[model samples]
Target: MADVLGLYNYWVVIFLMMTGFYIVISRRNLIKKVIGLSIFQTSVFLLYITIGKVRGGTAPIVADGFEVYSNPLPSVLILTAIVVGVATASVALALVVRIREAYETIEEDEIFEQDR
Candidate 1:
């Protein structure tokens, strides 16, 4: 029970990942797919933060009394990833807007049918 509770973050990550994947695959609306992708991206971010956490760890800085310093690389990388993810999501939404404008619909199946 203790072990399972300790890994709760991982369980949440798995749940979010699956839910996002399902939404992306099962939904026919392009907006829904984009939202699903954002959820999936959020799960990845949570997973990384969970992995980087350390018990009784201090910030990665030179201190006189601190010994167990947590590594900052993961957090730094995640920050950069968040910026990139936002840009990517914005671009995806912009494309979706353009697609909607061109096709007069945002449904994936409808768009495909129109193309056909």
Candidate 2:
């Protein structure tokens, strides 16, 4: 039962990642593309958190009477990645807003046309 639940969680993370990638690559709207990129980034965050989770491990912080501590490296890495992701998302969103204001439309093709 526990193994099945774990496998299911893994599958969900993979599905989210694939879907997010497909959206980012295939979508045409600028805002939609940013949304997709955010989703993809978040899916990666989820993956990191999932991997960091231990079946029966304790926190890495040294305290009183602690035996097994799960690895904290993954959590720390994910925290950094999440901050970077937010920065990227903010920049992308700002770019999309600028594109919309400049071209009067958020469609990728329209923006390209205005650029040319």
Candidate 3:
């Protein structure tokens, strides 16, 4: 039962990764693509968070007789990645907005046809 529960998070991570990838690839709208990108980023964040979890562990701060503590590195790295990911998503959405303004359509094929 413990092993099965532990594997649940892995399944979720895999599902999120695959769903994000599919959305990004199968969708044609710029806004939708951005949403998919965010999903992908969220999965990455979740992976880090899940990997950082430690059974019978406490916070990194000093405590009375608490010897087991989860590694803080993954969480720290995830925090940085989240910030960068937010920045990236903002930039991408901004670009999408600009494209919408210039082309009057958010669809990739529409933009291509308009360009031609």
Best by TM-score: 3
- Choose the strongest candidate by lDDT: 1
Per-residue alpha-carbon lDDT of candidate 2 for residues 4-61, written as tens digits (9 for 90 to 100): 9768877998899999899989999888888888888888888887888786888789
lDDT of 1 by residue, 5-114 (tens): 88999999999999999999999999999999999999998899888878899877888988897768889989999999999999999999999999999999999999
lDDT of each: 0.93, 0.86, 0.91
Which 10 successive residues of model 2 have the least lDDT summed? 48-57
lDDT of 2 at 115: 84
Could you arrange the candidates by TM-score from highest to lowest?
A: 3, 1, 2
TM-score of 1: 0.89
Task: Give the clash count for model 2.
Answer: 0
Task: Give candidates' CA RMSD values in order.
Answer: 1.6, 2.2, 1.5
Q: Candidate 2: global Cα-lDDT?
A: 0.86
Candidate 3: tens digits of C-alpha lDDT, residues 1-116: 99999899989998998899999999999999999989988998999888988989887777899999987989899989999999999999999989999999999999999999
